[model samples]
Target: MMFWLAFMLLLSAAQRGDAQWDWLTGIFGGGTTGSSTGQNDPNCGVAAGSRIIGGQYASQGMFPWQVSLQNLAQGGSHGCGGSLFNNEWVITAGHCVDGMTNPAMWRVRMGLASLQYYENGEQEFTVTKVIMHPSYTASAMGFPRNDVALMKLNRPATVSNYVNNICLPDRDASVGTNCVVSGWGVYDIQSQYFGQAPLSATLKWTYAPILDPGYCSQNYIWGSEMVSSIMVCAGYDHGQDDACNGDSGGPFICPSPDGSRWELNGIVSWGEQPCGAQYKPSAYTRVTAFKSWIQQTIQSN
Candidate 1:
């Protein structure tokens, strides 16, 4: 009788322990398990909270996929922002890597919230390969089309609470959906010398609602020629929130349709000067448009 009682007690303890674990996982997204090198991991896109830009500072680990694409040749200056696709790959805009394809000239800084100061859990990786989309093109005035690119790191990233992969969208987000845009870019658009304005030392984010393609094409200076089928338009008619210079190649992430996690929906591509201009929402490279290309390139290479 005593043996059976002890067995029941042990079983009850184990069940209670599992319940506690489940509660913790629900609160923190997931525990540190699963492979960090592949996108198949269930932990992808998990974060501590959801928020971004008219913009504000992001808490550490709030956007673990955010990364700074730094130019080593330019004294390690930040050239663009990117999203972590997987442990070994990063996604950015083709224009950001255009005419600057030398892998030796770049470094990727991850798990960091500031460009000017070192933070805990920061990781830096040397790039081994730069791959731009084959159909990528630039307009006469320097605007880009099919503006997506990928960078392969020398090795896979060491995933942690502060570093993780973002989910690739299974389908395109709907028009009017509010998405988050984060980067260490110029926050003040009203400066007289806007062209010479300094980039934000700390990361900033803002909310940009996806706009209708028809409306975007009509408002742009180049009209339909500029807002093609592969691009996405976001921001507002009043221009209160938008990505600007130094934010190129950053992520335009949105909540999954079910609101379980975040998904990378777009790549910051182009916007008008003195950004956040009325009726001129910023343009992004629609990530879903290149989904197959991204997967096949990563697989074959």
Candidate 2:
């Protein structure tokens, strides 16, 4: 009953353009909107100059690793965000493909910024395979465990300024480190009414500071939910920016100490209610914790 209610609510909220309609809220008690059984628009109601909950429009060719996961089986529309890990592989949240595991039903859009426009550099590819973590499990309250997955592209992407890969983190993310998160999620969560604002069409980027696991688990919204060591929490003390319903599977990137390159530290998994509330940072699948799993999956398969 809860699943059905959440599914329906997500559909209605998305169609109504409800700004407060966040998937990782209490609808499923703690679920993310990236589920295959439900729907969230990739570029549904973007306002002219707004951004991802308090972010700024990402410059063209700035985030080459960004990718859009579109569900062609349901309809050729965007569903979730993804990271171009390599020429033939893309990384995303496990829940993004949980219900719809068929690779034939999915496609990836690369080298694009505006979701409304297919620019000259945009490229599309059919997904050939999906490799979800073996321990993945969706809790009754909607929290997903081991919420990470990898997709294989039908063909290798030709790397370019607008399309490339991001480096994976070599170690666990450090607390207090500032990272960049980019996506095309809801523009704002504080809108007074639904349908008043539009979703983000252009990719957006924001700054988030990594939080201490102890602080996140003891003082945040999901305190009773138990923070997993494999997950990393990050947000602002003021909580103006965050990853929302459609932002799942996107990359949480941190810059190198020397500022030479960006490393893939986390994958947007879920967050607290109302999207970006104060003292409620979002949770991400710690990429560093699954480094071996990722490499092993890639090498064996």
Candidate 3:
């Protein structure tokens, strides 16, 4: 009788655990995600592709604020991308630095279009500190909430045509207009075996329109629960143009109404499985939602 009681207790615990897993799966969709990048390749080379699904190769110095976050743990391979917000700070996805917070083990490469090859104006900076959102909870099974982070550079980035800082959005900023996302992430999601080699070694970009929150939540297999108030969605329902692996923590840049400059509007957070899938749009951390928080953090730090 005692043995039977223990078995019942064990079964109950298992069921409860499964119930929680099921809930997350129902909200964020379920499927094993593949590697974020290929085995580390330090050699710089140009990528092969027409573009990011439908994007084009970016001209040198086009998006000067674009930067690459290199993982020294991964042999200096590009793990994720970021944007230079100012001389001393960069904004990226919190998930990008979740377990790899060692500042000495990371570096920021800016003013370069190619990952493997440094251009005439390329500059690399050592990271002094990493600050993730206090409420950030990185989950493999749930939406990446509060997915923003700031990296303090050891020295200020020299402002130039090829190394300018991107502007941030204000609290009242709204992005009804289409935004551009640039990165060196993989152009094809199915080429995981190729690893970092299959990725775009050169900078590439695609246009993803800002999606309505209500419509974004309803379309994914995980349903609307995957999208929180802090997140936003962009990409085609029937995938054509989208950002993929290695692109996380990059910017969703939009032009100012006056057309003189662009503002950082979004941070690449997470997306549906099999990136760029039909009817599956990618999600981003809405920058406006955290505008005040960003200000406070920068000031306090």
Query: Best lDDT goes to which candidate?
Result: 1
List, residue by residue over 1-301, the lDDT tens digit for candidate 3. 0000000000000011111111111111112121112111111111111212233566566667788898887798888888876466788998889877889979899878888776987889999899888898966574578889889888777655566666665442354666677888767645533443256778887777787777776744336667777877777666646776778898787665554456777888776544556767677788888877776776666
Model 2 stretches astray by more than 4 angstroms: 1-55, 191-198
- Model 3's alpha-carbon lDDT is 0.65
Worst 10 residues of 2 by lDDT: 3-12
- lDDT tens per residue, model 1, 1-301: 0000000000000011111111112123323343233344466777643332223666667678899999888888888999987678999999888888999999999988887888988899999999999998876776788889999988877777678888898899999987778887766765514445567788777777798888877834327867888888888777746677788898899878877777899998887765656777788889999998998888777
Cα lDDT, all candidates? 0.74, 0.68, 0.65
* Count of backbone collisions in candidate 2: 4
Which candidate comes out best when scored by TM-score? 1
Task: Please give, for residues 1-301, the per-residue lDDT of candidate 2 as tens digits.
Answer: 1110000001111112223212111111111122121111121111112222433666555676788898888787767888876466788999889978899999899878888997876779998889999999888877788989999888777655466666676676579987767787765766413644345778887777798887887843457455888898898656657777677888888865544456789998876545656677778889888878877777666
List residue ranges in candidate 1 displaced over 4 A: 1-40, 49-55, 192-195, 219-222
TM-score of predicted structure 3 = 0.78
Clashes of each: 3, 4, 5
For candidate 1, the TM-score is 0.85
The RMSD of every model to the true structure, in order and in angstroms, is: 14.8, 11.4, 15.8
